[model samples]
Target: MIDVEETYIENRVMVQPNHANNLQTAHGGHVLKWMDEVGAMSAMRFAGNSCVTARINQVDFERPIQVGDTSLIKSYVYRAGRTSVRVRLQVYRENLRNGKQQKATESYFVYVAIDDDREPTTVPELGVSSDRGERLRDEALAGEGQ
Candidate 1:
């Protein structure tokens, strides 16, 4: 069994002019790309193999992240099947100076482990070893969109 915490991944990206849209806010495409990358990393960590994005279960942009702000992304594998791993991803717009943050986006992604031939491969089971990890898993499963 793969521990939930072991599959966790966190990344930070400082929004720049190139990443912004016409409104000077971070482009939705860039944000989604970041989420996908982090989610894939988490899934691969849990599967112990290369994993590819099989599905974007859902993505909700709660707030816009402006240019010059930092985007903090956190991802973790909360569930796993024989060949698939489900990851929960969250992005926050953080104020570097004051250390305040707001939820900018949240989503769930599914990834499939792939073998050398690029065919689907079995992935290890996931198990939560801590109360916090269990709570996180349950909360992710019982979300607004599941």
Candidate 2:
């Protein structure tokens, strides 16, 4: 089994002009790409094998991340099936200058583990022994489908 906390992954990207749209805010696609990458990392950590995105739940952009800001992406594997890992992904906009941050986007991604032959493989069960892990898992479960 893999602890939920052990599957956690965080990444930060500096929003640049190239990442921004005409309005000078980070494009939704870029944000989603970052989320997917981080979510995959978390899934791989838990599955101990390569993973492929099988589905992405609703993604709502709560706020726009302006250029020159930092995009903080966090992900964790909250649930694991026999051959799949479910990850919760969230993105935040941070103003490094002032050290302020706000939620920018959130979503859930499901990934299926694959073996070297590119065939679906089994994944270990998710473990939530610590209070922190349980709380995180509960939060993710409650927020699912919302």
Candidate 3:
């Protein structure tokens, strides 16, 4: 079994002009790319094999991260099946000066572990062994209804 915390991944990116849309905010596509990358990392960490994105659930962009702001992405494997892993990803817009953050977007991603031949392979079970892991799982579950 793999502890949920062991699969947790966090990443930060400064939204630059190239990543921004006409509104001077991070483009939705750019945010999605970051989320997918982080989610894949979490899934691979848990599966211990190369993982491929299978599906992406509803993605809601709550707010925009300005071009000069920071995008904080957090992802963790909350559930796993025989050959699939479920990752919860949340993006936040952070103000560097004030050190404040607000939810920018969130989505659930499903990844399938693959072998050298690119065939699906079984993955270990997911366990919430620590307080942080349990809390993260609970939060992900709570958001499922929305």
Candidate 4:
């Protein structure tokens, strides 16, 4: 069993000119790519095996990550099946100078563990050993307007 906290991952990327759209905001595709990478890393940590994205829930871009700003992506595995893991992911727009952050996008991602043969492999059960882990699991469960 792997503690949810142990699977948690956070990454940051500075939005560059090439990452922006005509409006000078970070492109949706770039944000998504970052999310996918972070989510995969979290799932791999939880499963102890290579993982592949199987599904992504609705992603809403609430705010924009402008050029010269940083994007902080946070992800953690919340639940797991025999071979699949569910991750809660959130992206925030960050201002390095002011240390201010505003949530930009949030979503759920499902990943399947794979073996060396590139076949779906069983994953260890997700463990919630601490109060923080339990709280994060609850938060992910209640995200769908529950």
Which runs of model 4 end up more than 4 angstroms from their true locations? 144-146
Report the lDDT tens digits of candidate 1 across residue range 1-146.
88998988899999999999999999999999999999899998899899999888667788999999999999999989989999999999998989999999898889999999999999987999999899889988887375
lDDT of 3 at 32: 95
Model 4 C-alpha lDDT versus the unseen true structure = 0.95
Task: Write candidate 4's Cα lDDT for 41-103 as tens digits.
Answer: 999999999999999999989999999999999999999999999999999999999999999
| Candidate 2 ranges beyond 4 A from true positions | none
Off by over 4 Å in 1: 144-146
Q: Estimate, for each residue in 63-137, the C-alpha lDDT of model 3 and write its tens digit.
A: 999999999999999989999999999999999999999999999999999999999999998988889899999
lDDT against the true structure, per candidate, is 0.91, 0.95, 0.95, 0.95
Question: Model 2: per-residue lDDT, tens digit, 69-98?
Answer: 999998999999989999999899999999
Point to the candidate with the largest TM-score. 2
> Could you tell me the TM-score of candidate 4?
0.98
Question: How many clashes in each structure?
Answer: 0, 0, 0, 0
For candidate 2, give the lDDT of residue 44.
95
Ranking by TM-score: 2, 4, 3, 1
Model 2, residue 106: distance off in Å is 0.4
Worst 10 residues of 2 by lDDT: 124-133
Q: List residue ranges in candidate 3 displaced over 4 A.
A: none
